[model samples]
Target: MFNDDEKPMAPASNAGRPAVGFSDAGKASVKAEHSKEAPLAASTISVLLDVSSSSSTVGRAPLDLVVVLDVSGSMRGPRLEQLKSAMQFVIKKLSPMDRLSIVTFSNKSDRPCALRAMSEAAKSDLKGIIDGLVARGGTNIEAGLETGLHVLADRQFTESRTANVLVMSDGEQNHGDARQVANPHGVPVYSLAFGADADMKLLSDLATNGGTFNPVPDSGNTGMLAVFSQLMAGLLTVIVQDLHLILSKPTSPDDDLDKIIKVAPGDFNQETDAQSGTVTVKFGDLFSGEVRKVVVDLLLVQATGSDYEADMLEVAVSYPDSKGVRQKFRGQTLHITRSGAATSVRATPNLVAENARRQHAQSIGAARELADGDDLEQARDKLVEAQNALEDVLDQANPLVAILRTELQQLLDRMESPELYKAEGKAYALAAELSHARQRFASRGDVEGVRLFATPRMDAYLKQAKEFAENPDAPVPNADEDAEEEAKANPIALVAGSLAFYIRTAVEALQAIEKIVTATAAAGNA
Candidate 1:
């Protein structure tokens, strides 16, 4: 055997197509379709998210791996042996061109033991050092990080590719607490927690800076080794690696949905693969109220042809105001396809109907307690808990139900002060939002699904807004922002307001929502 743990003698030229994200069933379908390729590992997919919206891959290639092994007294047994075996797996998996280094700390301030290099010679030598590893001394968490950085040498990292540190530990950083001092390695570091005695926080902190932290609770060293393997293999397929996203730009939520979506820092990293070719992506993020912009970041993999495609990525964000009022905005699956993997990404944005129904009943009872209680936070707590429980059932994507979930969330935000005009207005707006969401639901035409969706309170506030706004006795609307503050909404006002909103959204989605609402009303009246 020419040393399975020997360093990769040469760098690999990534020359394959990018893979797509799909449902498990869809994935199986594709796998079966491609079963004829005997040499292909179709089951292996490398997924990279473009979280940076720049044209460069952060000026780095991808392999910045630092091995932080634990040789403390407890790890002296077969555990240490298993770790070396796992380390060997990583060595066999990585390319010679990627950066590799090792760090170990025991006792108060012991110097690190490391062999740093970007060549096969360095890795080859490190394998021997790994095999000859001996367990001694107590754990000193601070020293491990300090030595990791000393070996990494910050000044040299600017031109490195895939700069990262992999910290494997079964002990806490108990000796001293200088973790934050030398911890900012200015790159991603993945944490691997081993055994029961490992400190999750220490590993989490180490992985917090531009990296991910993973835990190996058992002695499944093979799985731990595979994590690194998957991460590296995906990196090789990427071309454009930078992306950014922002949602709901331009319009103020002061009551609007005809929003403008903008993508800031929209540039993506440049990328190309042999089979799939080059891929460029647009990244985005969504904000509440009137959407003025959407920002996105992405890692471009490859494409099969010139046809435009889109893949989906979903994001959820929320904030709680001082009065224990919660507000939120949800982004559906992000699509990134253009002769690449975009069209295959799906968003199963389904509402938890079963849970929502259960909560709806409990909420009615809770509403009684809420009205009698002065503690808004306490009241809000129950509401959030219920909503969270309902969110659990979301795995399918249906539009009508989407509206109810959004409405329920908004209702939770306003529950504390149902009498307040602002809260009431929000409720009305939410009702309108639900009305729109319902229209999308009809497109699916599943009776059982529709019945489940209709179970939620349609909260007819928008219908009331319309009647009040059109009242002959009501004064002409004031354009002043303060005027909106003084206005109190009733059923008529809600119906009129709802109509105006319906018109705006109808135009925005190019689907004529107002027409649909009008038709709905007429059919109901008939």
Candidate 2:
């Protein structure tokens, strides 16, 4: 769950774009783990590949844009200039594949502008229309949105691809209802809200249906054109459709740590419900498998949904499910020692719980291998021995036990029954049962508990795991070695060097040309 107060990594005011899954891989030197795998719907996999890889800008859907502007008596001074400027920016930034229509609303206009399709040839015409716009009437924002939708709905943009609607307003609805306009087109209407008097709540809701709510970071200081350009260019970068992940039962067939995971459809934007000191994300239809590493970037928003606040910083989350309620995931606790302080690292409640269930499923698969063994006595003994050797150790740190305690404490805080005590037991019981199903996987030397719960690519994961397993208290890599690694990884130095060389060559060429021209002129004069 993302918090509004968490400053976005890509600031709204920044004209720069966020490096989507590319530069993060250290200058695209690595092959993708998830980017290559096709999501549930193979059609929307455009984002999986690099944007530069394709000759097209096609996304999961093609959006038809209608910039419904509210121009009335109030938008007379700086507001009018900002509004027109914003439209200009939007026109320049709109991708050629996308269609742009301009509509302005005012009480004085005879008929609202009908949506016009944008093209290279039509670009001049759209500019002409914008220039011709007059501001002599009262505000009628609702009417403008209605008109925009009517024009858009007239041409079902969402038939296959997605439909996008952007509404810019500064005041409340003077006429008509924007929400009541049956969006049969499934068009996601995002809004750029302005003016202190406007209903920001409505604008935010409108954007959530797939649109983005972008308030000008600083009012009066922005050119409408500049802001519009930023929004249009920024919107295209979001390619990942479903972000929430679940690991079902991933395993290593060899001694190699394999990352097996699939993606499914779901919406996970900012999780508001997670603010109660418990971050929980509910899963819907999702692709599941074995997961090795999960990295999530949290932007410290300073304070989103508020104006002019700077009290936020980005933080990485790496903690075990703290509120330990019985969960499906039986996660391994990584004892993390950072800053000379040791703390048991655990997965988030949501991820850990889901993973526990996945591990249980893997364990069950192992039981089947145990049953097929030729030596029954050996199989039973091995299974019993493995089960007993770790039973006490596991029971002490059993995820269920910790969860029950936390859940019971929570219930006590609320003055309610600690049902999770029983519930947690059931969750673990189900996991163990799932593991128990694998009766013979152990006997044939084919099973090693639930595959998902275990480390991936046993060799790779084990190699790394053993280093940590054996020297859990050892100091990290030396500063000198780390400095050398940093020197190799730094790309900025290369960029700077290239720019310096290019300037030097340019200067040398200029001097050479000057000498040659002077010599020719001297010869001519003589």
Candidate 3:
């Protein structure tokens, strides 16, 4: 589905029409829709990155990864074993074109392996190092991070690759300033907190600052493996890095535009220049088959006279491709006509739905935070308000609305049960942890049930690979003739294939929380 030949198109010479760059690739298309109203009416213009199946693989980059593991005393038993298995899986999945490094930390940091290309020999050596690791002493996360950063920096200077860090920790930082150490690293850090005791806030902050996701696994080896597999899949399919969108202000004084806000693919960074009316938004990375949507509210004050063209806005996009090639795209002057006729046009349904989904997710997050603070009444009120708001904008048939309704109902049920509300001990702790993990996953715009849903396909691919290796003369698979077929046959071979693992893990954690809550409620009734 990915079209590597699609390029940004220049707008026509016409003055009053909206123009886009890379329209075929769906890179920077602008849609301006206005409500039918009097002279002083508002409109909304959406900027969409349509990374549909037909055009998802614009830029594929080889990965340069650094895996930072925690070998603290807390991770000594099943946690350490799970971590090792996860690392082994990652090593196996990486192609020879990719490079990897390993760093482990307890009271101090140890570099078990330097940046090495992925070969059979390298993988065997890494596996041996992982197998020999023993958990003891305290956690010094800063040392591990620093070592990983150094390894990545060294590799970056020698070769051009998409460098990243995968930090797996199950404890807090007992030495060194992790924030200070990580701030200067050029590579993104994808953190995975292994247990309930892991510092979620710290891991979240680290990943956010590094422009990546932090996923926490549930309390089990299966959960750990699921989260790690998903994270690795995401890392393997990054298409664009350090993507930035710069928007110049509208030229007409009669036009007013609200600050641009991200509606999908999770929030990143936005900056505005008040004097120049310029806005810069930083999108850390764009994966294959990922569509990013941003929305802005616009008001046009028009005079009742002859139709005239007014400049609306201009957008410029810049990012580095997988090969470390700097690519830039610019949009033509966006213009709108002012007329006396009372004609209105509706916005795109999909864009509207996306904005509504973002609002819904944000509301859920706010309500959960309030509940965590023991403000049950406020949390319920927030959820109700969110539901009402969604109903006003989204149709009942919208699947996202249904999901929001279900989540709200679940929260309501939990709040109504006094015994469940006050439940404590391991079950409560696990539920709370999973709840946070689910919220974080939603914030990242990850689809639910992806990991488990993709497992059978992944297994099938592995089985085929084993068969091919044994025979060495199997007919070439014609999977790529259709994107869906190819993904089902070999999920890791496509850009969207890797996301299945992360989504699956998030769904599993949520399911576990539900089971825990249900068991607690039944026991209380007994």
Candidate 4:
């Protein structure tokens, strides 16, 4: 426990590099909670590390994005057309500050469009190039990735700019090993498996650098566009990069330090230092209004002090600001109140943290493996068990619980029937469950499934995209138009503003009628 005179450490700053004001007042906040705050004796303490970014985060960084496309013979007719349409949507969505590069692969690769700012003329040229792309030859995914990674690596500006690669393919690679292609710059390479024939495992392996391998079943232009929109939503609103969380025991005079038993970092990579007994988990980048939860199990020793609180762990979060300067949030202490009586303390669990653990269980690849192995019974049973565990902690009426229930039920449905399991069922189940656990938004298993968990911005853009797809002649809505529509949808404040005026006018009319009646009566009496 911290002494009365002790204060939380201030945010650390680099000495030379200038700190740019990027996010809002609170860039990010970290809080740790225990399932059982007060325990009678030594027990496993479930520590939930809740990390969130500010909703009002400002200073959007410029983007350097590369779209690596596969123009193999397999993607001939509708597949090629859908790919072009998706590329056009991506180009339209980017702002002038953002740069886009295109790479097409068929046995080999070609960079038709280099990294250039998204000006009106540039966008037009890119769209034309996309339309002119012809599908032929075999797939060389390695060459495409190599070209894309090189294009992104050779950037003119580094400060206050974000870079990423998007690889779209629908066929197996007949060329070099894609996994061997090094991502030295650590730019996130998101993969879009276009159709059923696409190798999801290869794509998944390639996306180890802070990216997701999203499976897009052969649905249509809308399906392709939906996935793109979801990816862009996070990429465009990047608030922090190279984020890391360090967990360690609090300092004390006695040799009684808490032990970090285990950690479930969920899709992110983690490293533990043997000498220092500190664990660091790399979260890569965080988007505005995004949440990343890390669960840790600790063995806490009894505190040897007169204070009533026992400090168990200290959590410190660090990330690079837009200017490439390292900024650190003050370390926070998770304390449990010390109790004397054995029966006095009640073990109350933190439902949010507990539910997150349950969600993580579903995403750990067990269900995916079982489903892939054709063990439908075991897979369904695994999902049911996780769902039941979630229900045990949370009520069915809770929105969080409902989301888990819906997800589990959908997976169960897929497992019971062979037809559904084969037709994008397994893909959907894995992607949905993983997205939930990782807190990354993705398309639903059913191609036409409604957007369940997209950011407000992404959801609006998707709605507009669907509207335009329905009728190409209709004018596409802009941000201002979206805001207006939202205001119209909820006009309570507008009505309230005029409510006072209406009441005043009504009262004045009643007073005038009373005066007129009094005047008429007086005149008749006279």
lDDT of 3 by residue, 1-526 (tens): 1111112122112111112221222322223333333332444445433321212322244567788899999988888877776666677666555677888999999887777766668778988998899999999999988888877665433333567888878878999878778546456777766655767567655664334443444444455555555555555555456667667765435444443433333455677886776777676655444444556544444445555445556665666532456566543335566545645535666667666666765676676577668787887798789778877764668675676565556556656543544331122222223322322221111223212112232333334434433453454231121224434465443433224333444674575466569768979999
Q: In model 1, where is the ten-residue run with the lowest total lDDT?
A: 26-35
TM-score, model 4 to reference: 0.79
Model 1, residue 33: distance off in Å is 29
Tens-digit per-residue lDDT, 475-520, candidate 1: 3221111112212322232133224334443553453344458658
Name the runs in model 1 displaced over 4 angstroms.
1-62, 108-115, 153-157, 183-185, 219-223, 226-242, 246-526
lDDT of 2 by residue, 1-526 (tens): 1011111121121112222221111110101121122111111111111101111111212235667777776667777766765565455434334456676777722233333334445556776677666666766666766666666666533332234567777666666666665666555565655654555456545653434454442254343443354344324322222222222221211111111122221233233332222222222111111121232212211111312211111111121111212223221111111111212223343344333433433433343234333333343343344334333333445564343333223222221112421222222222233222211000000112122222111222223223433453443232122222333565343233224434544774575466569768979999
**What's the CA error at residue 180 for candidate 1, in Å?**
2.6
Backbone-clash count (model 2): 38
RMSD of 1: 25.6
Let me know the TM-score candidate 2 reaches against the reference structure. 0.39
The Cα local distance difference test for each model comes to: 0.39, 0.36, 0.55, 0.67
Model 2 alpha-carbon drift over 4 Å, by segment: 1-62, 108-117, 156-160, 217-223, 238-526
Candidate 4, 1-526: lDDT as tens digits:
1011111111121211122322322455675666434544565666777776644323445567889999999999988887777777777766666678888999999988778766668778998999899999999999999988888676555566778999988978899989999888788888888777887678767765667668887865667877776787677667567778888877633323458899887778899999888999888877656778777877766644342445677787787755578876545656666554433333235545355555544553577788788877787777777766775664445566666666667767767776677666666665665565566676653433534445666766777667756775465542223334444565442233124334444774575466569768979999
Backbone clashes for every candidate come to: 81, 38, 5, 0
Error of 2 at 215 (Å): 2.5
lDDT of 2 at 180: 65
Better of 1 and 3 by lDDT: 3
Top-scoring candidate (TM-score): 4
Distance (Å) between predicted and true CA of 172, model 3?
3.3
